[model samples]
Target chain A: MDPINFVILAAILFAIGSAAVLLRRNAIIAFMGVELMLNAANLSLVSFSRIHGEIDGQVMAFFVMVVAAAEVVVGLAIIIAVFRARQTISLDEPSELKG
Target chain B: MVNPLLFWIIAALTVIPSLSLLFARKAVHVAMAIVLVMVGLAAAYVALGAPFLGVVQIVVYTGAVMMLFLFVLMLVGVDQREDLKETIKGQRWIGLLAAGGLGAFLVSVVARVALPVQEETVGEPDVIAEVLFQRYVLVIEVLGFLLITAAVGALVLTHAPRLKPRRTQLEVQRDRVRVGANPVNKPMPGVYARHNALDVPALDPEGQPIEDSVSRVLKIRHQTQDGAEFRAQLEDPARKDTEEGR
Candidate 1:
């Protein structure tokens, strides 16, 4: 399989994820979009690792996974708190800080 | 030669559900879709010869992180639908255009740039660990600290102080008297009542236990008979027959 194919796939997935983040109103779904983008990047990293005949890309992928996990934890906590306070998880609902 | 067929199949699996994840209306469905995508990505990782990352992707993202997402979805309840009204006018169209432009640019760049392709090397877990713990030790430690900070920050954000502060027995009694309601007798209103002090069974004002919608639809009701009598009748068919005959 051509390594460029994987890169193309990753690019397409990242684009879909970006579209989701842009278009979705639900904060959780937007968060899922962010995760999808991260996964796409991880795929590219693994592909590059294979292309380089080294383990560095895989190690970087592992670090990305760890960071993604931590990010989800904090992000979900903030989303839940916002939901608790305002009774909505819609990103546009929290306009108090908009000004 | 690497199997292109497997690569195409896994790539399709990874991409399809990730796109669907965006369209899922309910948060729970979105979470499940993301899990499917993560599993597909893990398969892709394995196909790329990073077995360790593939397994870790499944264990961490699909297993733990997705579970956390599901937990939050359930905790917050999935019944609340998001308001679809756009806060910023024409944002959706602009976003779509931007994303499309970005995708085209990336694909073109990837096609044009010829990276030197080396022979595929299967990542050995031992070498990864050695490099991670030796050369990238500081980075690993920093990630550990970030995780801890995330945990603490999550707790701080979501923690709600108890509505009723801790009070002595006398203070509780005085508050009950002052409020002109017996704290021990009256049921607390609202979904988040701290405790059911009266040990009252969950029942409506009609003195009947609230039946679930499914049970109501099925026309099922609780038996009025005692537990011991119900057990005896189940144990002896003859006795039940005699009672019916009588």
Candidate 2:
């Protein structure tokens, strides 16, 4: 299989994830979209690692995974706390910061 | 020869579930879709000859992170559905247009670039570990600190504060008489105070149930089970439990 196929697939997945992040009203779903985008980048990294015959990309993928895991914990905590304070998870409802 | 068909199938699996995740209405369904997508990505990693990455993807992303997401979702109650109404005017159109534009640009660049066809490297765990601990050891240590920060930050963000001021036992008795509910000193018969009776949720001074998401869900459930009479008793605190007389 051509490595470009995997790159194209990553591109498509990234697009879908970006769209979800921008369009979804739910904070948790938008957070999931961010995760999807991160995974797409990881896929591209692995494919490039395969094409170049190097282990650097794979190592980078590992670091990305660690950061992503940490991000999910902090992001979900903030989301849950907001839900508790306001009783809703809709992004539209938290316009109190609007100046 | 590696099967091109397998790559195509795995690619389809990866893309389809991610799309479904965007469209899923409930948070639980979204979590499940993310799990499927993570598994598909792991298969794609194995197909790309990164067995170590595939295994890590499954263990970390699918196993630990997704489990955390689902646990938080259940704790926060899945009954809360997002409002589908567009919050920002034309936000959906703008998002679609931008995503489409970006995808087109990336696809064009990818199609035009020439990737050298080299022998695929098998990323064995030993080689990855050696490089990780040797060259990237500092990064790994920093990541450990990051994880610690994340844990502490999550705890701080989700910490629930005490709802009311602590009162002395004598003060509690006076307040209980003022509110005219159950006496503070007497425990209900047959119910161990610590086991069941002592933890009876305190109502607001107005005798209304606390307005929180979980209690709101439990209230709805109670209403559905007992129908109109139960709902009336809930709304009116004046009604005594006639069943307790038996």
Residue pair clashes in candidate 2: none
Candidate 1 residue lDDT tens string, A5-99: 78788998899999999999888889888998998899899988888888899999999999999999999999999999988888888788966
RMSD of 2: 9.7
Model 1, A4: alpha-carbon shift in Å? Answer: 1.9
Q: For model 2, what is the C-alpha lDDT against the true structure?
A: 0.82
Best of the candidates, DockQ: 1
Per-residue lDDT of candidate 2, residues B1-246 (tens digit): 247898788877888888865677888888898899899899988888889999999999899999998998887788887787787788789988998898898888988988776887788999899999999999999999999999999999999999999788999778878888655333222222222322233334575433331234455556312133444665664545554554
Segments of candidate 1 deviating more than 4 angstroms: B166-246
Each prediction's RMSD over C-alphas, in Å, is 8.6, 9.7
DockQ-based class of model 2: medium
Could you report the DockQ of all the candidates, in the order they appear?
Answer: 0.72, 0.64
Query: Model 2 compared with the native: what TM-score?
Result: 0.78
lDDT of 1 by residue, B63-172 (tens): 99999988888887888787878778998899899988988999888888677778777876887889899999999999999999999999999999899878999997
